[model samples]
Target: MQSMSTLVFDADDTLWENNILFIRVVDDFLAWLAHPTLDHAAIRAVLNDVERANAKTHGYGSRVFLRNLADCFERLNERPATEAERREIERLAAALVFDQVELMPEVAATLADLGARHELALLTKGDDAEQRRKLAASGLAAHFGSVHVVREKDLAAYLALTSELRLDPATTWMIGNSPKSDIIPARQAGWNAVFIPHPHTWELEHAALDPADTGVLQLPSFTALRGHF
Candidate 1:
């Protein structure tokens, strides 16, 4: 049997559908605004710009996303957006965080199997209440021994969590899709990492992993983790 270890997972796209829901809201908002001069791609660029900047200043969550959408509308829309349009943005944001999202294939089963042998935990970055809401909705909270929500998932935060949990960097593993947040920083923090790439991960989370990132394992899917752990 493999040695028992701590397995920390990232919540959003790493475990379940997240950005896709936000994408839907963006598409809906774009449709409503229908910028006269710009097509969807051009219009979305404005929103993307807003998100990237706002993420630095405001951090992240449904509320921030909703605000980003409104801000983008005001920036791009030739005419002033009506209160109805603003309300619609709020509705979409509420629906996303307030409802249960579909978990990735084999997530529950794989987490169950791993949790049986390894100490499982969560290290995800986002707005605290929204992340908690998503975790509570996911129905996999019991599998985790601890959960951490942070404003950012940089190397410092990783180090903080490692110290907080008293985890052995040699034996603990970080499992998730975001190369920027989950894989890179965790490895830099001296933890083992397993990368399960998700096609729908947020654009902001994309970062190329160092080809020589030692102790980093890439798997085909979440269920494939059963083979390694």
Candidate 2:
């Protein structure tokens, strides 16, 4: 087997706690919509519909999620929001930004150790602005030699990165939390994939894969990665 020298990682839930904040905010919004004057199920349905419709337009992140909340409120009330309602939404959205995000224990140490031996890069999918901010805040930014933030993680993106970096797929590994966005595509592109499952990954990010995808390895924690390479 070829020894891996280049390592790529997905941001967001892979390195830090992210989706949990979104889920918490959504749960709070649902609670607020459960008042006597509102139909909880109807409100949830409208929010789901708005999310499905706007997901492509706004993409994933706190901003898009806040927009969905605003749309859901308007649909529920059937009128423009009062100042108080608007303030509440803004407050909740702002709170989501500072919800105590932190790197998983051992992630920083593992990355630092791995970087000493490999060409480490971060390849993530999100709004570039938010992704960059998160990386900078996490203090993991400096460890990576390269970073790529794109709309999606597909075969083309993987191929392009390998081409641009002049990396051999056989010796490159992609580590991430999402099977749909990271593992499947990387495996398809003939790159080694390591799955580090996050506790709060979104349902849409899940994907089924063949058992023969032996190049795709799953681990309970990032600490286990030292042995894989």
Candidate 3:
């Protein structure tokens, strides 16, 4: 029924407004700190170090990220933060986790159309609970055949998913906004990758495509995705 054998989609940013919401919440949290001299960039750099270290073991999600932030705040300030300050920071982080899922433009229509004719799967990297919660809230769960949420998006994880799906890598397509997490790994696993670039993608997720390889495709918008099928 479909031109492609299967389609694997990344949950955040590709299907909905995820990272940008996190960015906004981080900005709010930073403002609440009221540090006049430390700009957002410097503050984020400190936070990034903490997150990267924590992510290796705790994985990605709001809970782990919030904890890392708390740790970073204390380390940067050279003293433990007050309970009230921690609470304020947590409140901001809570908004990101509990907020209603906001679909990108044409996501609903596009998914509905694609679902009718193809096998669709959702793959994301985050804490199991938070990722599942977001997927449930997304209202797009019905469209997917299965979902996989991992602590990391590496070659092993991708291989495991494809093995479970009984998919031929050459015929499967991985679609997402992050080059590091979605595109490169999929391509490395011998799967076709379609990149739907998002402006607010996280710095850690950034990666440049190789010049010689041309199999990877890029779509300007979600609405344009149907044309490929």
Candidate 4:
């Protein structure tokens, strides 16, 4: 709808390889724990447990996940890690926030084109500093008129954006990777939503809904979004 004036995007998986990087690092750490002295299955179980526990307590994002991983490593090893191992783990953990982050193919081009015609905003949830840094470093900061980095993705946050922007939900669309965090909530808030699945979405992020469930639209990629609006 050309008349729709505001477009809000979810920043993490929607635009880049975020959760996948953390999963990769966790897989690497699990491999390291397969040493003769460690129980591989037990270690993996503990890591999964820690992740579930932390998800409830700390919420999502690379920074919080890394901290939980570090604590789990120390507890499982029953001793402080060697300097080399510590450095390695820390490096892997930090990679989610920094390292090599490239925009998904066509994301920049799509956003640039959309920015010219609509009021583009980023509504993301993460460690405030890390999310801001990623947006800035990815060269996406200039395209968005406003960026909201919140601690959690909830009804309140969605409502706040509409209120702050003086936008009617009927004319604002939310584009994101998570059905739970983006699609359902946007629909509930009376806004349209577009779901573009990322390859490495976490289980927590999965929420099933029929295409006819609401006004939420599901697309395979950002490049396909132009035709939807």
Candidate 5:
């Protein structure tokens, strides 16, 4: 690690507890459904399929996700969802999103320590306004010199960001929990990456990195960065 380098961070599970909130809502939804024939795993498969398919068209956010759950309910129940059911789903989705922005252990202090010497930036992908709202509520927004909330974190997006920021790929490092979105793509974009694994990361964000990419450094947790940077 070099002194005063640009450090790009993923906003969700890396910096704070994010996926767990959605998981809690999904648990509640499954319990409420109470399908007599389907086991929890079976039910989840259907819902996961629905979410995967809908993601392309609807994008991600509480509003889009709640609507996808409603569609999943209809797909499983064989009957149209009632107004009450829709409202209940919305109520559950509302509980997360902007309400809970709990930072991961030692994240605030670690970021504070790193921010003093490094150029901190935030790069997260989701619904733009919703992601910003969460960042605003988190109270860590001020630490970042710039923030980017994109629809997706693909190779092109990473390259575009590097160009836009006028960053040197050799000195810029991306730190995050998602290998698929945050690690692999950032590495492919020619930036060094620090991967801090999260146990309960969202299933869709999991990927095995190619052994050939030697630019990535793996750390056990967020606070460990203080030792390296």
Candidate 6:
């Protein structure tokens, strides 16, 4: 609420299209499988399970996503994949990882507006190289005071960042799409949180906020965020 507030923005869905890209890749995989009897919903459910399990072991990014698709197919089919099928999956995953980063509508103007008014920083979680690549490609990097790439978005991670930067929790704000990662953890750290919901937010990133916990401010979209400042 203060003019000098330190604002941390999540880089993925908050600034650009991330989860939707993964969804598109998954759809392509389903089409390639072409299983007449298998329900798409069931396969997606299995794929989600595989992704979570594999994330714990292999961590996140394109390679882990490819492995998840491969493991899910094998689990459902009860057989090893053919060389051609493996190649197709690898090609699709590579395309996704290497694809140009696309910013959300009005993101550039919105970030520019906010950057002029406050201390803006980027706080994103994922493979360091992948996150940096996306950030660099976004072309909005110059607006930020600092950029942080973390393996996870949790209370401890935020705390560590704040400590290192010497930011006061009382005057800092975290703005992002994920309630599980962006809002809750920021609020828990005694900082302000603004939730900007994205349609394709990953299921693993979803969480319900208590009605009594009215600290988090929810906006319909990123463009609307400029009004708050």
Candidate 4 TM-score to native:
0.86
Q: For model 1, how does the per-residue alpha-carbon lDDT over 1-229 read when each residue is reduced to its tens digit?
A: 5799999999988898888888887877788776778999998888889999999999999888888888888887655568888777787666565458789998999898998899999988889998988899889899998999999999999999989999999999999989999998999999999998988888888999987877899998888989998
lDDT of 6: 0.87
Q: How well does each candidate superpose onto the true structure, as a TM-score?
A: 0.93, 0.88, 0.94, 0.86, 0.95, 0.94
The full ranking of all candidates by lDDT, starting with the best, is: 5, 1, 6, 3, 2, 4
The root-mean-square deviation over C-alpha atoms between each candidate and the true structure, in angstroms, is 1.7, 2.5, 1.7, 2.7, 1.4, 1.6
Residue-level lDDT tens digits of model 5 in 163-211: 9999999999999999999999998899999999998898888899876
Which portions of model 6 show Cα errors greater than 4 Å?
Answer: none
**Which 10 consecutive residues of model 6 have the lowest summed lDDT?**
91-100
Q: How far in Å is the alpha carbon of 179 misplaced in model 3?
A: 0.5
Candidate 6 clashes: the total is 0
> Candidate 4 residues 205-226, lDDT tens each?
7888776666777898888877
lDDT of 2: 0.83
Each model's lDDT: 0.88, 0.83, 0.86, 0.81, 0.90, 0.87
Clashing pairs in 5: none
Predicted structure with the largest TM-score when compared to the true one: 5
- Which numbered prediction scores highest in lDDT against the true structure? 5
lDDT of 3 by residue, 1-229 (tens): 3465688999999988888877888788778776768888888888888888888878888888789879878977889889997887788787775447888998878998988777899999998888888888888889999999988999999999888989998789999999999999899899998899999998888988986677688989887779887
Tens-digit lDDT track for model 2 on 82-140?
88988898887786663345888888999988877788999998788888888888888
Off by over 4 Å in 3: none
In candidate 3, what residue range of length 10 has the lowest lDDT sum? 91-100
Clashes of each: 0, 0, 0, 1, 0, 0
User: 1-229, model 6: which lDDT tens digit per residue?
Assistant: 3477898999889999899889999998888887768878888898999988987777778878889999998988889889988898898777676447889999999988888889999999878888888887888889998999988889999999989889998788899999999999999888888999999999888998765776788999999888888
